[model samples]
Target: MTPARQKLLIVTRHTPLPWEDGAGAYLHDLARYLATDGFRVHILWLAPHDRLRWKKIWRLPAPFARAVRLHLPGALRLGRRFVFLAVVWLPFKARALDRVRRALNTVGLAPPRRHPSPAPPAAAPLWASPPTPAELALVVRFFEKHRPDVVITNYAWLCPILDLPALRRTCTACLTHDIGWQRAALSAPGIAPEITRDGEAAWLRRAALLVAISETDAAELAALAPAARVVVAPKACETRAPFAETTSRSLLFVGSDNAFNARGLDWFLREVWPRLLREVPDVSLHVCGSIDRLVTLCPDGVAFHGPVPDLAPCYRQAALVIVPLLQSTGLNIKLVEAAACGRAIVTTPAALPGAPFLRDAVAVAATPGEFAAAIRHLLDQPAVRAATAARALAAVRARLAPATCYGPLAALLRANAVARHDVARDLRVLHASGAHPPQP
Candidate 1:
């Protein structure tokens, strides 16, 4: 008989939505690969990324239509929490609503709240808080009943679930997106509780296996928890067929409204953007995705085209992509995406740790002056830009394809499954001999 597919479950608050953000895209690619490569993938997640879509909701319906769409039946289907969300924030999102909601809840009259409400990505304190006891109870019950061969969770914060007694019979893995303490760099002062190195290290130790998104992140994580098995699996991508390079003098930036994108965009506007325009005055920069909401200002020549379901049209129109990130951790998936799309790029050294193969393929500039010059140089020479874009596309085809990126993780899991099966056989033989089963 053919061997049964190994069962694997992903536990995360950051639900996978390929277009939502880099983390979402990473998880989506991971799930797709696992499902195809001998694993029956399951998920225990909180909410779909940004279910509110506050920025795009107005554009969604004809005037006054969506307001009517938020009726009682809609609330039932979405659960009680959706009703609270619709009333407390959707129609007229105001500071005064906070007072109204508080008064209702204080009198035990709050709207039916049956589910966990979605928080804005990376901005809410909820991102750092551990699940309530009741929530963790549900997770424990599911883990015990399912008894998956492997359990992979996205964040170190969720490692609490990885420590369940059931894990002794399962391979627990923590998918480390980045060094958690590095989040302190992007957060506002006093808003986030101190995320120390020791705290991060402690969380990582709960898992038997650790998956890192980059070599740099893996090295740090390995140092943090020397006993935890660490494997580097860079974010997965598809190698797109070579597309004609754009002659249009437009630059594209795609990101979510998270702190990292906000910080990088803020720095770009304050320091790098003006310098870029001084050289290429007629050139336009098209900003895509939710990151637009985080920026307070959009100067002339820069356009914010909020979140879209499709990025193909945006990619096709831009001459080059710019990633002027001053601070970030792990792999910058956006950099890999631009390369996969065959777009010439002008980026900073900060974005290269995850995809070092990109270092030679794209233009790398360190300072604001140099960054602007690189963009200007690519803009002025279409031949050079196309050649560079071609090089980037080639690099992704060779190195960033899903098989190339996800293979090592797959190999490790397969080996563990065989080991687990052998251990089960030993236990059966011990049972026949009236001997106690060995601890896993």
Candidate 2:
């Protein structure tokens, strides 16, 4: 008889949407890839239901919104203490409210406020959370019911799932996108690096395997978790055939509104962009992604195209992509995406860790003057830009393809399942023979 396909459970902090952010896109691609590899993949996403629900509630009136915003955090904290009781209490209230809502609808007094789903690429059944004891019990029960052969946690933040007793016998892995402590240290002031590192390491020790997005991150994780098996599995990008050249003289910078992106964009606008404008007055910089809310100032020659539904047009029309990140950890997904689109790039040393193969392929500039000069050169010389873009595309095709990049991770998961099964069998044998198992 043919053996049954192994089941893989992925637990993440949020349901990944393709258009949302880098993490979402990465997870979406990974899920699809894993599914194609014959694993019955399921996702357990810990959605922030409380936050979303509160946001919806607050949007009723301006005064009510402000009041709720001020008290929401404290209310949540207090609610957590009595969450079990609230679970019992809220359902009855919810039923009554639903009845009233239905009555209103029957009378044609109120319109429905429901919206359609965002329709994620890999649409796995989701389990959202305010993370109550009851909710955790449901999660534990789900794991018990499915008994997945491999359980992979997407981010370091979701590492707490390791504490579940149901997962004790499962082959568990953690896919660390970056060094969490390093990014946390940069973003949060007054927090010691050692403290954050220790906390992350403690949770990571529970995993059978740890997958880092880059070699640099793998090395760091190895140092922190000396006994844990850590490996590098770089972010994969969908390779595209090189498109025909366009005469669009615009530079593109695409990133979500995060601390690293904000800091980098602010610095670039303040330093590099002005110099580039001086050199090529006709050249314009088009900003894309969730950056509009973060950026307060909009200078001339800068177009903020907030969160485009499609980045293909942006990439195709752009002369080159700029990643002037001053503080970042892990692989830069945007850089990979840009290269995959066959666009030339000018980026800082900090953003080069993820795509080191592209060092010679794309322009690398640190200082504002160097960045401006590189952009100017690329704009003035289309042949040079095309050559650089071709090299970058070649590197991505060879290195960052989904199959090439994520294959190791798939192999590791398979190995972990075999190892786990052997250990369980050995334990059963030992128990039958009345022999005590050896301690770790």
Best by TM-score: 1
* Local accuracy by lDDT, each model: 0.77, 0.76
Q: Which tens-of-lDDT digit does each residue in 183-245 have in candidate 1?
A: 664555566545777888888898888999888888899899999999988887775575577
415: Cα error in model 2, Å: 2.2
Give the worst 10-residue stretch by lDDT in candidate 1: 65-74
Prediction RMSDs, each to the true structure: 7.9, 10.7
In candidate 2, stretches whose alpha carbon ends up further than 4 angstroms from where it belongs are 1-3, 48-135, 189-195, 422-440
Candidate 1 stretches with Cα past 4 Å from truth are 1-3, 48-125, 186-193, 424-433, 438-440
Q: What does candidate 2's lDDT look like per residue over 1-440, in tens digits?
A: 11256788877665354455777677767776777776777766444335334343322233222211111221233321212234455778889889989999899899567777888654422331123454456568768877888888877656667778888777888888888888878876686553377788887887778988888888999987888899787878887676666688899999887889999999999998888888899988899988777876778899998877578989988989999999888899999899999999999998887778988898999999999999999989999999999999999898988888888788788778867877878899999999999988
Q: Against the true structure, what is each candidate's TM-score?
A: 0.80, 0.78
Q: Poorest 10 consecutive residues of model 2 by lDDT? A: 65-74
